[model samples]
Target: MSLQPDQAIEVFYSYAHEDEKVRDKLEKHLTLLRREGVITEWHDRKIGAGKEWQNEIDTHLNSSQIILLLVSANFIASDYCWDVEVKRAMERHETKEARVIPIILDFVDWESAPFGRLQALPEGGRAVKKWGNRDAAFLSVAQGIRIVAKELAVSS
Candidate 1:
């Protein structure tokens, strides 16, 4: 069931606007995967002009094989991120349709969050902001994503 070399996995990023800086840093770290053509990422920022944002977000959220949640204080407070995106991602994960990876971006008490049952990135669920080197933190997250992508490819 291994995917072909040309196969590409779709990845969706769900984050709060307030954490855009960390999200951008994470996306930058993922550039290697994009360059290698193993994964294509989509976020709200990718929505084209005049496009129905909700529809666009829904389409990507449903179709992406992997969903990354940039968890933080703001992300946890956002109804849309928690109620809509994370909920849907959890559903897909339950059905084995996708893998959900929560990328903790800032110091936040998320142990009680719905996605808390799942494993988080940056290892040990440590917030990226707490890392001595943000770049190193992002690199760790990207490497975890690479492993997940490879596993999904094999399963597919």
Candidate 2:
């Protein structure tokens, strides 16, 4: 299943609420990508209200063409993040309906990540050492998002 140009490439961002700083930076990158016409819409908890969090998440997940997993310690610790987002992304992978891009923001057991076999952005393990600088890390992540956006655009 391919996306339509006018459909707005929906990206479902999965991350732990505890990593608010990382998530905020990612949202900013997504907003920048939108302004550049790289993507039409981006969805994340940062824009949703507490009253309908679950519903809002489901809406984006179902409509998304890709899933960006912000792998972090707290993300792996959250059951909802693991069970719902990870599981759904796995299903999407199985059907080849959506692409799952893991962006390692913090130390996570890559060997045990939901889909560690899939190639990840910013690399993993020792490569994370370079991400110690916040600005550099965000820039690397933004580059990864651009790659995904290009792939989606071409595939569509």
Candidate 3:
């Protein structure tokens, strides 16, 4: 079940526009994995100039092996993230088609949210913004993603 050397795990990012900075920070931490070809990251910013945004997003969402939800008050309030992306991520997760990881980027009461029961990143649901060193938080997330990617490779 090992992945081919050139086979990159597809990771789709779901976040609110308000959380873009945090998402960008998190993406920075994933550069190593991306360069190593362990994962291929996708976000709305990657949409082509002529592509229909929603259709492009849905294509990536449906094909992603992993989905990262950047959780925040704004993200929770976002209709597209909460109603659409999260819903689709959950469906894929439940069907064993993809794994979903929710990373808390800001203080938010998301324990009652759809992905609440799942384990979150930065350890113990700590918000990345609240971390003493933000890089440490992103590092924790990166390590967790590495573990999941390895597991997925093995299982596949």
**Which candidate has the top score in lDDT?**
3
- For model 3 the local lDDT of residue 106 reads 92
Put down candidate 2 lDDT per residue, 1-156, tens digits, no spaces.
Answer: 233447456677888878767777777866777666666554464455555777778777877887888788888888998999899988988898888888777766765666788877764332333566766666676777777778877877
Tens digits of lDDT, candidate 3, 26-55? 999998888787898999999989999999
Instruction: Compute the lDDT of residue 89 as modeled in candidate 1.
Output: 96
lDDT measured at residue 43 in model 1 versus the true structure, 0 to 100: 96
> Highest TM-score, which number?
3
Overall lDDT per candidate, in order of appearance: 0.90, 0.73, 0.91
Q: What is the lDDT of residue 96 in candidate 1?
A: 93
Local lDDT at 35 for model 3: 77
Inter-residue clash pairs, candidate 2: none
Query: Tens digit of lDDT per residue, candidate 1, span 9-116?
Result: 899999999988878888899988888877888999999999999999999999999999999889999999999999999999999999999998888988788788
Clashing pairs in 1: none
TM-scores of the candidates in the order shown: 0.95, 0.82, 0.95
- Sort all candidates by lDDT, best to worst: 3, 1, 2
Alpha carbon lDDT at 22, candidate 2? 72
